[model samples]
Target: MKVYDVEGFPNPARVRIALAEKGATDKVEFIPVDVMGGEHRTDAFKAKNPDAVVPCLELDDGSHISQCTAITEYIDGTFDGPLLTGKTPQERARISMMNLRAESGLLNAVGDYFHHATPGLGPDLETDQCAEWGNKRKDVATRTMAYLDSVLDENDFLAGDTFSMADITAFAGLAFADFAQIDIPANLTNLSAWRAKVSARPSVSG
Candidate 1:
């Protein structure tokens, strides 16, 4: 498999982390797609993924898979290792719920603030920015931190006691938030501890 992504980007980082958890990082070839240089907007890349997003997986047979969650599902299912996606139906539903929550409330919120409020990528890429809407999304992202803190207070992980995809999404979201200069409130101690534990994993550090 060929993995196309830009290093340090949030969505790509999520897929990389998933691949690491699946023990399949060494099995695939990493191809750099220069989003900063508008390489993703090229005809070649658009053919592979019509949406023109990175972290796309190209199979040996020439099939392409995009979207972070779909790519993660493929990785977890095809590889033999620790399962990031849940094994049971109930676990899958719970993980999916929390994962979507993290995606929308944290990750997407930061992305909106970055693209709409700040000079994201550049003027060429970030058109139609509205500071008012961007500020609203920033506020949403901040409130999400508190909600996640409460969730973490009850359980060790986002979905439950075990480390799962939801936790991975939250981790990636927080990393994006940090990059966007959004600070996590200091009062959220449970969320802080959970982050510390997840960050210590070799998947993130290595």
Candidate 2:
């Protein structure tokens, strides 16, 4: 199996963390896709993912998986190691819901803000063009994370006590927010501790 990969990006990092959790990192081939240079938009890469996104996976069987969440789900089902997707119906539902919340709320918002506001990564829009949107997005991202932190405070993981895909999703968003200079407040200690734990994992460094 091969992983369409990147560095200095949160989505790829999420897949790497799932790989570590499943003990599958050494089993798969890593194919780096350069995102900073817009390599993902090249014709060759568009052939794999028409939208030209990073962190896609090409299975050994010739099937391909796109999207960070889908790739992690494939890893969970395809391997026999630790499961992040959850084992029971209720667990699956809870984790899936929370994962969606994190993806749509914290992750996407911060990414949108960063793409339009951060230097050296975007098209350099006029300040009047994206400034308000960026500021609002940053605010929403932080508020969403605070809400997520409260959820974590009540449970060891996002959905429940068991470590599941929701934790992976949230961690990716939080880490990405850090890169965008948006972070959960220090008062969100539960979320901070969880982030620390995930950061310590060897896969996260990738």
Candidate 3:
């Protein structure tokens, strides 16, 4: 398998963390994509992933999978290590719900703010600028931080007692938030604490 990505980017980081958690990081080949150079937008890369996004997974059979969640799912199922998505039906559903919430509310929101509100990746990539919508999404990211803090007040992890995919998504989201200059309020103590704990994990800290 090959992973096409720009290392250190938030979305790509999500998939990398997933692979590390599964102890499968060395099992696949990593193909670096020069997103800043417009390599991802090229037709050749588009053939593998029409989305033209980094962190795309190309299977041995030549099939490709885009999106962090989908790539994580494949990694979790194929690798031999701790489960990420979840084992039971209820666990899967809950993790999936929380993952979506984290992605949309924080991760994607930060992305919107970065690409639209700010001069992200320079003038070449960010062609359509919408400061108003980007600011609105920034507000959504803050609100979601509070919501996740409230949830963490009752649970050890985003999905439940165990560290699952939801935690991975939220952790990456918070990292993106930091990059976007969005601060997690000091009042969000639970969220801050949870982040500290997650940060200590080998998958992230290593």
Candidate 4:
């Protein structure tokens, strides 16, 4: 397998963490796709993923898998390692719900505010910015942080007791939030403590 991604970016980081968690990082090749250099926009790259996104997983047989969660799911399911998604139906549902909330409520909101309000990925890639909409989404992202803090107050992990993809996604979201100048409020102690725990994980640097 070949993984195409840029280092340090949020989505790619999510995939990398998943790969590490599945113990599959050594089984694949890492291909750096330079988003800032517009490498992802090329026709050749587009052939693999029309969406022109990074963190794409290309199988040995030339099959392509896009979307971070889908790629993570594939890796977790295929590899013989710790499961990040879930083992049972109930667990899957809970993890998936928390995962979506982390993605949409925090990750996507931070991304929207960065791309729409601020100049994200440089001027060439950020053409249609809507400051008004972006501002609203920024507020949403902040609010979501507070909500997540409350959630963390109840449990160690986002989905349940074990570390899962929801935790990984939220970790990536918080990193993205930092890049977007969206700081987690100082009062959100639970969220901060959770971030500390997740950051210390070995998979985070994968």
Question: Candidate 1 vs candidate 2: which has greater TM-score?
Answer: 1
lDDT of 1 by residue, 51-153 (tens): 9988899999999999998999999999998878898999999999999999999999999999998997789888789988888999999999999999998
Q: What TM-score does each of the candidates earn?
A: 0.98, 0.91, 0.99, 0.97
Per-residue lDDT over 27-111 for candidate 3, one digit per residue giving the tens place of the 0 to 100 score:
9999999999999999999999999888899999999999999999989999999999989999999999999999999999999
Error of 3 at 21 (Å): 0.6
Let me know the TM-score candidate 4 reaches against the reference structure: 0.97
Give Cα distance to truth, residue 73, candidate 4, Å.
0.4
Per-candidate Cα lDDT values, in order, are: 0.92, 0.82, 0.94, 0.92
Error (Å) of candidate 1 at residue 184 is 0.3
Give residue 169's error in model 4 in angstroms: 0.4
Evaluated at residue 183, the lDDT of candidate 1 is 96
Local accuracy of candidate 2 as per-residue lDDT tens digits, 50-165? 86888889977787889988888999998888778888898788888998999888988888788766662745332334766777888889888888888977887888887778
Error of 3 at 13 (Å): 0.5
Which residue pairs show collisions in model 1?
A: none
Q: Considering only N, C-alpha and C atoms within 3 Å, which residue pairs clash in candidate 4?
A: none
Worst 10 residues of 1 by lDDT: 119-128
Model 2 Cα shift for residue 53 (angstroms): 0.8
Question: Which regions of candidate 3 fall more than 4 Å away from where they truly are?
Answer: none
lDDT of 4 by residue, 3-63 (tens): 9999899999998898888777799899999898888999999999999998899998999
Query: In candidate 2, which residue ranges exceed 4 Å CA deviation?
Result: 120-129, 202-206
User: Candidate 1 vs candidate 2: which has greater lDDT?
Assistant: 1
